[model samples]
Target: MDHNDLSARELAARIRRGELRASTVIRDTLDRIARVNPQINAIVQDCGADAMAEAEALDRRIADGQQVGVLAGVPVTTKVVSDQKGYATTNGTRLFQDVIAPQDNPFLRHMRQKDAIVVGRTNTPAFSYRWFTTNAMHGETKNPHNPALTAGGSSGGAAAAAATGLGHIAHGTDIAGSIRYPAYACGIHGLRPTSGRVPQFNHSGPDRGIGPQIMAVSGPLARRVDDLRLGLEAMAGYAPDDPWTAPVPLIGPTFRRRVALVKRPGGIDTDPRILDDLDRAAALFRAAGWEVEEPTELPDLREAVQLQIDLWLSDGHEAKLAQAEQEGDAGAIALLRHYADRAAAIDVARFGEIFARRSALIRAWRGFLEDYPVVLMPVSGELPFQQDEDLRGGDVLTRLWEVQLPQIAIPLLALPGLSVASGVVDGIPSGVQLVAPPWREDICLEAGELLERGFGFPALLPR
Candidate 1:
């Protein structure tokens, strides 16, 4: 089998059983990235020498009869926003090009300790502020399936890289739709583990504001459901740096396969094709001895979604506006300008009120989840958009908002959601989002596996 296409679990098992060497796997992955990265612009900075040295060390350890972690010898990619020792943490911004880190962020360090080989850093928009990955720094990352459509942003490079077999898995962070949207666009699986289920911190800079502190989370994207589990287990290791990092097991003993499916939650205009895909997945699950309940609506979704927007942009409003002015990137400027009209007018008292309401919304969602272990919904309202499309335009933003329904609501309640690729419509990937109560990533994983099996896994593009 091609090493690049092997799931993370498969790669680790082969290495552990002496069927493959760490060096061979890492080298093959590096070669794969070199072959395809020029077209997709997925991997930004290569760490060839360091990755090879790490693989060599792992080979010696195995020879010495040492026990390695679950991800041992698996090649992985990290988002540019995450800190990796000896590399500059660009976060896809020119303002911080020289901001090199002396230590690894907790998530990267945990993955490294699991013996996962780091091949390179993936691209992101400047400050990871956009949903489509493009900026003045790393340039634009194209979708692997269709270069004319978006790869999905923030973690766009991660998704494209994983989709094209550049790496076994790629680390991704989600504030809004970063991880899930990219996974949907790339025809892969990505998890947004419950807030702080994975430890995350960038010691090189001051702590981020409340909006990001509450919503931004680091997780994984991979080509296979099994690989998603492997990536999450390694990334979820506990650390004290992030106060929100819950020290909990992401997976637990098996449970019933019952799920809740919502077609148009909160009156969002879901595309007809996507609704058909959701119904098809429900039928597949029903045949697999799982009960699928069609729910008309979810509690507090509209209010929670509004709260998410308010909380997310709370602190960065002015700074981003000024930066947008300086960069003169039309897309960034337009987005910031639109938000500025409202954000700049809010008083500190009103901001506090939003938080108070946020608490209430979280409570309501928690109550709702008690009866539904897994809620199935659309990943995006419609199909992927054209390349370089400006999402900030009035109608465009409305569509973007509707398509990102789940992304908009989950953060307010601090829940975990995963995007499992279902099928493709017109060559564009379509996916279903699985959401669960806070700290119940196991539910997401279980449903994701069922979906992956029901619809046979999609093949990667040939190198």
Candidate 2:
């Protein structure tokens, strides 16, 4: 039936109306994964047998006229970093390769509660640190569109799975630009909801540190913004284990359909092609009755990036460096070396100052959002890099890190950022990032839909 080509929402609706059986859909999904996963290395842990059993059970429930979940019959892939029950939460590192999970984190728990079948677990870089996905344990996840380009990291596998139709919607976590960049690289959509918008906790590991508490969040990746919205609704809810979680409403106060456009964050220019997409995106907004404004000045993203680094490294980098050494993962070691000097100087006092300064930064962005509900910007200053671009250390790696300030800065402000895939530019996938005030993901998704109107979702790979 070519069910893989439909959106998660559409598939779920079909399941609800008895037009499709959950077991048949999941079996087809597993078959597709078997055929395509080897080429991309996206799904590292196949949960095919378990997913099929669950699907069969769901089919029975539906036959009995039982009410199903919002994501019924939808096949999705979970990021390996999260503790999916009974699976190894490897985080793409050898250190935790044998540590089995005891229970599902908020993500998979919610996904299961909503009857979404997880066909496999996706890969990530060691420590979920690199912008490119690879590890000694699971190997590298390549872009489904172009193997030469990277599958954006941390959540790269999730994006690739969605881009290739291996999964209709994918579970993705974003602390920096993990979800957004991967979505851009693979020609899909991902949302980095405001911190705590989606509850998270790892029973397989220790409690989350302060920095992650303030910045890290789990969100969704999909080909359709509508599916992304459905993913969010199903995954968001209070989980007792996470102290940071709350019963925040999915929809927020309405605002003017206005957008603040940023071509260059911190005065750094983007690729010419990205600039053109930004132009086309703005025109689409205007045509859709949105007022687009190029603000004379915007929040200081460079400073935000600086503070984000300090807070992120507050737990000290030496321990991580030692772990990276033990894992013998080149990319992880390279990342640690690149930030050694900066992370070395951060301590208790610096962390204190970060929070004090963070308040003002958040206030500034909140004020700006009050004026303009959404910000239209590039997901990355550069296009998807050649695969393993970070492997070439020294100046090349440093430049790669600096170029992603647009992505690095958002997590610091605790705002919702949406990555909307525009189209393929000269064979590489290109996209824009939409930022909304904290807890206002609705605004970002609404803005993304408008930009998507101009350059519809890219066709799935392997055509």
Candidate 3:
């Protein structure tokens, strides 16, 4: 049987029914990773030996008539940015390669509690600061669809691993477009759950600044929409470590299937292919009995994007900027310098003002989403760019940021966004981004499932 082709949902069901053993799945997953990871460079740290031991224990528990959790024995990979007990939370830098985590982060603990076996740790850019996944410590992560194109950062490794079947699900974090863009580039499904939906805290690292505490979130990336849903089910819960985490239910009240299709939110220039994909996805929703409309009445996304940047660097990102320089990753250096240039101009008063205005922006988006339960926009205004395109110059970085307004804007509002790969265009993956009101990940996932069934996008495995 092709174990690599099975979704986490399917794999877990089969395991529970005794048609497959936990050890079999672990071995198959590790073997597949060994065969493919060399070219992709996705799984930077393989935990196969420990994973096999855990899987064997799970099998023994099953044989002893013990009831396991929903994700029983499913192979998973956690991004290197997160704390996984005993592994280095490298965050893709040579400086911290030996910074071993004393305990698992809340999300990792949750996954293990549900019986998900962590097979490996994926890579990321230094400090997870770049949109393209490459760093001095872990090297570059290549897109499974096209090696020349970016795998997408900072969760590029997670997306690449999931797309190539290294694991059934990959854990990812997003403060900007990290999770969404990687999934779009690698041709998979990734969900950036509403802030506080999933508990997150890194005991090994310093406490996050206000921007990340509110905007950054942990989510799941997978090939199947149902698998994303299952992942959220296991991941969403309160943790004492994260004060921001709220006790919200995993599923929200159902709303009318009304979607607002924004061809170009904030009037940014979108590539022709992305617009075509949006139209195609809108048609699918219309055919699926959804009320779809192209509405010009939308929130000021550009303002939100700028504010998010300011807040991210408001705490005088000099320390991180210094660290980026020390790490000597060209991409990270460029990104930090770009933001530092802007940060230098802003004073404490202006930073305070920007933080204060975040509430109003959230209100504006909430009101807009009330009329339209879902908003379908570009995951990126353009398709995946050549790897390290941002390292070209400041002008290229500016253009890249403009094209990524769809991704950067959502984080400021602390809302949930899902990237669903529609199809391949011009030898690269293309997809649409879905946003809903806070705690409305269920709506995004449901809409994604509809688009998934209509498009029937084929999975892109490594050649």
TM-score per candidate, chains pooled: 0.97, 0.98, 0.98
What value of lDDT does candidate 2 attain over all alpha carbons? 0.89
Name the lDDT value of residue 325 in candidate 1.
68
State model 1's lDDT: 0.84
**Deviation in Å, model 3, residue 411 alpha carbon:** 0.7
Q: After superposition, how far is residue 294 of candidate 3 from its true place, in Å?
A: 1.3
lDDT of 3 by residue, 61-171 (tens): 898889998999899999999999899999999999998999999988988999999999999998898878888788889998999999998999999999988988899
Residue-wise C-alpha lDDT for candidate 1, range 1-463, written one tens digit per residue: 6886667887898898778999998888888888889999999988999999999999999999999988989989999998888888988888777888889999988888889999999999877867788878788999989889989887999999899888888999998889998998988889998887888999888898888888999999998988988888898867988887767876665566778988887877888888988998899889988889986656868888777777776457888778766765666676666667677767889888898998888887787777777888888787777776765476776567666777778877889999999876677888889998888898898888888988678668665
TM-score of 1: 0.97
Q: Enumerate residue pairs that collide in model 3.
A: none
Q: Give me the runs in candidate 3 sitting further than 4 Å from their true place.
A: none
In terms of lDDT, the poorest run of 10 residues in model 2 is: 308-317
lDDT of each: 0.84, 0.89, 0.90
